[model samples]
Target chain A: MSTVSHNEITVTGLSIGYRHKKKEVVIASDLDFKVLKGQLTAIVGRNGIGKSTLLRTLARIQPALSGIIQIKGTPLTAYRNLAWAKITSLVLTEPIASKNLTVFELIALGRQPYTNWIGTLTASDTHKINEVIDRLTLNTIAHRKCFELSDGQLQRVLIARALAQDTQIILLDEPTSHLDLHHKVSILKLLKKIAQETQKTILFTSHEIELAIQLCDKMLLMGSDGFPFGTPRHLTDTGAFDKLFPHESVTFNSETQTFQVRD
Target chain B: MNEKKSYRLPFFLLTLVLVVGFLVNISWGSIHIPFEETLNALLGRPTETDSWQYIIWNYRIPKGLTAILVGAGLALSGLLMQTLFRNPLAGPFVLGISSGASLGTALLIMGASFFSGVLTQGLIGDISITVAASIGSFLVLFVVMTMASKVRDTMALLIIGLMFGSISAAIVSVLSYFSSAERLQRFVFWSFGSVGDLSWPQLTLLLTMILLGSILSILSIKVLNTLLLGEQYAQSMGIDMKKSRFILIVATGLLAGSITAFAGPIAFVGLAVPHLTRQLFNTSDHRILVPAVLLCGAILMLFCDLLAQLPGSAKVLPINAVTSLFGAPVVIWLLVRKQKMVF
Candidate 1:
């Protein structure tokens, strides 16, 4: 249970939010958790619960309001941008302003931190990219423009891009928000498989709590009162899932381990 | 991989058109020189008539070269702006650098008249105007650069640019209203845009500045491609957003400001050529589009310059008039023909 050496990300007393014009608006504070390597972890919460803020803060895209975030025992801020890029990657929910890039080219761009000044792919870069494309079953559409892709295919491609980045950790924000139920499950399963196979820590934020509890090895449940991080069953047994939503509208059925309406 | 092959034929045809356009532009001027004589003059062979050599060397070649340089410069500038803003409508002139140049020109020509003799000398007048235009543009560039550091939103930057443009335009209007008839005419003529008036030294300066801008743009190819993925993604890829944006804006300002100073704000080449290149090349890769837009811009400018000369007649149309009249329809045609825009 103590996998401190295998921790990909560790936070101590972290507070994440935004500061505007000398005014600080804290979304979540006093957070502490560790994400283990070779596991799929999901951060789940209701609307406006600072899921994205935590991901962005962990990715080092936004400054953490306060506290310690250490990646492999190094302070998050201690790593330079380029070096951090090699250790962690992000797949965002925002629509890409893609021009004429093929799926292959888009994936190859994941090597930006490692590529030469002009971003020309080397033999190994191309080899890694090809491997990702094949693993994701994207060979048929590798030559297609990213904008030409279906939502399911594009999500796979985005994950493939993160894999191609060759990072020890990947952070995703709502990676399956726009997909159907089947796609949502498939994507989560794929993420689980990728984590086990590559031994990389993969964390994503999603609203699909039931699916997350089913597939994820670990879960970070953010509530209005507290943030709890533990294995899905551990959190469930600890009564963390029941307090996630308002008790008036919904209740967590510990037997089924799913949300049920209080009729 | 095979996508590259699709652009080969179009690239070949574009090169052919550029060669033909270059020759046609040199050959078809007032007091027509024979094609053979024009070719001979271009090859450094002395033609039978001295006027042919004088016209070809002093006038035709520089004008032709000017068209190529400004065309490429403006097109690349437009490409940079569009990529930086991620807006299809963005262009080199979007930041109001041209208006700033106009304000400078207006102040020099109009405000200098109040001094009577300070800027009226031949070479001094020309130098003052160039200096004034550069001053005006750099002033705006400085302001935009300062604002760029503070503003992260591209649309906000665009709006600030428009505001700078409007303020300069208003100042120009006031200057024009208070100026004498002859000074006002001079300012109006400059606004008409000219490719034929650049002397050898001026052309040299234009080519050099454009070369600098183009090199900066080339250095930014990787960053530009990353930017298409949006800012946060680009940053995650290790791109320094502030540095990339600074280089992009500075490159755009240099190319746009210099071209406007010399060519008097040639229209449509920068704005239209990039869109046209994107359609024809069918790729958003800056590596391909940079060179493709460069050639397309040059060819389109040569064609416009050729038309502006009115070919058989002596009277030349204003270059701006020809650019909008000719370039606007091509953009409209591209828009009307396509069901959805790629970018």
Candidate 2:
């Protein structure tokens, strides 16, 4: 909303895709969106939708076919690797083989962008990491190896790593995919609280549209045909939720903020 | 403050372990040298017996140091390769670097027989197989690096490395087929691995190469740690995966290639040491893992080298055979225990 600062991320006319054998397969094109600072933005779509691809593009993990993504009004390419790392961090759904890493060690890695050539963490860096671990409630298991943690705890550990990065914007892909309902709500609540408290922009994708609509400040709804972006209320009122599901049984109920199926 | 203390403890213990391991290595060998004698010799104390002093200085000291250095080098190389490829199984031997060194040594030993002048002029005597081995190691390393850059997936790169190793093995077999019995025996013996064969000069060169390569690997720890999350994550963190991969491969080659050149493709230590170190330290931060693996590798290799000497007998088993005896079971145990440890 209007709370978005001048330094917020702006994607203009973004055409995103990958090149294979000299052929461009565009996932989404002519996409224009502005992500407000300190807001939790949910990207919701059905299976095979370009939600993950769009998130990847926004995080600069994948190249946009032909478009401009600006951070603080500067083109994404203007910032060097360390500069970008300092500004943005990402959490993926893929599991990593961080066998030897403790939760604290893994979180400490978020300070890599600021660490010196020898990769030494300074006192202030350690303080920041401890603060994130405490923020994520990971202090009890901070000494536990990543491999030893449960899926829910590991997910929080990953978020702690991102928090330790001290970035303005964080992009996550299906962070709730593998979690149980309790963990899912906990992680979403954590993200929402982080967005509010830290003033950090968070863009995440999920198949749980109803949950996202309730928790997020704004939503980007992508479908097979096109994508529509707006606040959850605006999108729900404009019938954007109608196009999300294929069956006629389910309908989006704006007043109750819930999904219903006709008898 | 407590967290900082916890982190520092492992580093201090690792340093202590390395120091103790080095001393134990010096004391235990084929000859039953007492700890006092070894310590005296190490500290420049004169012994009453010239032969004891000579034995410690000329033979045991260099060989002992070589084992430590070679062990550290191979373990560090394995750690770097595994991190760079993001494959737990990836190592110099898995990637064909060892096979390449063997092939190069085969070429040198076989090619020398063809030129009588090469043997007569003492060219074969001075040339040393280590040089040929290093060349071969570098060649395969370059090929692997090139292929890794072109390929996007870690599994594909691992497969390509295996393929390169197979090709090198094929070439080595061809060379062995035509070589003279004497030359074949030499090549075969070298392939079995031995830390005892290195002279002082060769040991110095090996140390220098390994130290330089390790320094390079340490310098890139930040990039490597980022890479643990995955290449895409690493890229978003501002690391150019291509450049970092190139540096890592070259560094792996230097450490792996040099050790193979001097020690003759010692097996098990490279694959097992890093894994063991990772388990012992329970941390993937390369800053800790790197040195921890180095010390663990040295200790394991030195212990194996001692076993190879076969105390109180003239019979010396191939160092590789001794290492494999200990190494293979550790790897099997690791595989069996895989369910317990998550990587």
Highest DockQ: give the candidate number.
Answer: 1
CAPRI rating of model 2: medium
Residue range B118-169, candidate 2, lDDT tens digits: 5542554524687888888878877887787788776787788788888888
Task: Provide the clash count, candidate 1.
Answer: 0
Enumerate clash totals for all models, in the order shown. Answer: 0, 4
Each model's lDDT comes to 0.89, 0.81
The residue pairs found clashing in candidate 1 are none
Off by over 4 Å in 2: A1-7, A247-263, B5-54, B110-126, B177-182, B328-339
Give the clash count for model 2.
4
lDDT of 1: 0.89
Weakest lDDT window of 10 consecutive positions for candidate 2 chain A: A1-10
Per-residue lDDT over B128-236 for candidate 1, one digit per residue giving the tens place of the 0 to 100 score: 7778888888888889999999987877999999999999999888888888998898888888898886799998999999999999999999998888888888889
User: Where is model 1 more than 4 Å wrong at Cα?
Assistant: B1-9, B112-124
Model 1 chain B is weakest, by summed lDDT over 10 consecutive residues, at: B1-10
Q: Tens digits of per-residue lDDT for model 1 on A1-263?
A: 76679888899999999989799999999999998889899999998989999999999888999999999999999988899889999999988887467898889889899988888888898899999998999999999888788899999998999999999999999998999999999999999999999899999999999999999999999998899999999999999999999999899998999999997
